[model samples]
Target: MSQNSPTAPFSAAARPELTADPQRRLGVLLSHGFTGSPASMRPWAEYLAERGYGVEVPLLPGHGTSWQEMNTTGWADWHGAVEAAFTRLRADHDVVVVAGLSMGGALALRLAADHPDDVAAVVLVNPGINSTNKQLLALPVLKWLMPSMPAIGNDIKKPGGDEHGYERTPLKALASMLGGWRQVRADLAKVKAPVQVFRSVDDHVLDPSSVELITRHVPNASVTLLHDSFHVATIDNDAPRIYADSAEFIRSATGV
Candidate 1:
């Protein structure tokens, strides 16, 4: 699609790539959140790529485009994209680390659960596995009536930071996301990889219930608090902490 097209699958500012490094034996696959583009995860991917590690940041299907287009796709489409990237990285790298933000985190966890031996570790920032929002329960009926609700993008506290996600949230796509959330939570115990989570102290998008559910099920998961940032901590003030800590987690988990 043309970059200027309104229906383009990606934003002009967002640069998504499957970066391959033949010399690097380690790879990191980073996934962006639901309705969001690779723009949010680009900086994190660049950090790992600059350190000589292979990185893959794929744009989820139906995302980066308009919300109406996103409503046509489902969770399987998004997960399939991430799984493909992981499989490709596993073929080339000695070890692979999977990391994500929000809904992306749920996808990463699902990958670790499904392929325990292939994933070296998992890093999550403000993952959304469970929600206390009662409005979600009405999604099934609301999707047929209303096409979308308000946008949930650019929840970052930092100035001039934009996630480049959809301006509206498609209800049908959100219902599909809820299914993915339930499946991931059901298989949380199957995740054998070392998992590290970074949670924000003041998140406008997700509640603490999500974090509580994840830590309650996942075995020996470590949680860190981001005091200054909001939901999009990957681009907030605490982003450096996430980058540094995740690198350390990868090294310790993979023995690299």
Candidate 2:
């Protein structure tokens, strides 16, 4: 996994889709966080796929490629990929649930806000909505001078688990992520789907304000606090809880 490699088609660890039962009519679209590949969401997707649900985990543009390539892309490119996946799921299923991790959560919220009738429910794990990091205030200026900063992946507390994300964080792409957060935050009221958010109490990557902002606006959004996980709770110790709770949430929301 070189940081200078060229962008290619989905790799074995990049994107994986599973078709459970053709007649299930229930679909799920799971998106990975910024700089992350489908590897992070594979386990969760598989869990649902094995239970007779159509699942698609897409690799966002510039991800699963190289950090340099990720630098060239923006939030629009990432959101576009997720939106396309969601559209495909809607076409084949009577009900669709959108779930994501970190920045992917922001994208899911955006989709729910834009297509409320299409999304049956929304589930997020350690979603990155707003950041309290002071460095972000200088992103507009820093992105012109510095191409990247330290990596922000692999925040899982479970040892040996990997998120398969970039080792370097691209500033320009990060600024674009922040822009998406701002947009989603403003339109949170437009999200009419049932929202279920899982927050890790010990997450080191995201600020508490992020979840606060989400619950404040999403009207009746349910928040589940993870006591024993870091930012990447999808692969952390509480992963099973997320899987089980989300499964129940989807079943209860859509009656599938």
Candidate 3:
């Protein structure tokens, strides 16, 4: 799922103080997973911004509002949102790296493929490319009959480092994610930008073999395995590694 900050920002005061130097040319567009908010990605955005890389973590449609609102939205809305974010980044930065967690990773991969010229590289953390979890696939049918399921995770991991949210999930929402993953896989061959995929061996949600399938299909992909983390490796035990490795991969790809 894509996430941002704990709550929506009211104005400029809610954002981190960034430099106004337009000449400082580096940038990164961050996408959070489905059923999540920009709050989940804000920490990483802050990390990169502090290092002088301008970053924008956008709120996807249906997200950061309510579960019912998210159910009404689909993959197209989410992709369009990211596309707009990338367009703005391209107009401002010399180098742009796309990064995401879970479903957000799928969106990032799609952007890298469709806009290869605009993206310098990509970083995926436990990307929910394909559901290794069979239970989720079965959820849609159940959701059709019963829309809301109990919350999936123990807690919602926040970008400001808080884990609190309704565990109740919308079945249709997960179905939308599966559809997006299928589309992303179909376009994998076109993603020429180098990719760094971080997957946790202990990820409870995604199948471990999904990592191998990703490396095999992605044209220029490198894989990193996290032995001890869960699905949210971006904020779990291996978070530091994911953060460091992503920065290194971006540096290598952009030659910065």
Model 1: residues with Cα > 4 Å off, grouped in runs: 1-24
lDDT tens digits, residue span 1-256, model 1: 5543322322111112322333348878899998887878877877877666778888788987689999999999999999998898888777888999999999999999999888889999999999999988888999999999998778999998888888789999999999999999899999999899999999999999888988888885899999989998998989999998888787777765
The residue-level lDDT of candidate 2 at 173 comes to 95
Show model 3 residue runs off by greater than 4 Å.
1-5, 9-24, 136-140, 154-165
Number of clashing pairs per prediction, in order? 0, 0, 16
Per-candidate local distance difference test = 0.84, 0.85, 0.73
Candidate 2 lDDT over residue span 192-242, tens digit each: 999999999998899899889989999958999999899889888999999
Clashes counted in candidate 2 amount to 0
Model 1 TM-score relative to the real fold: 0.91
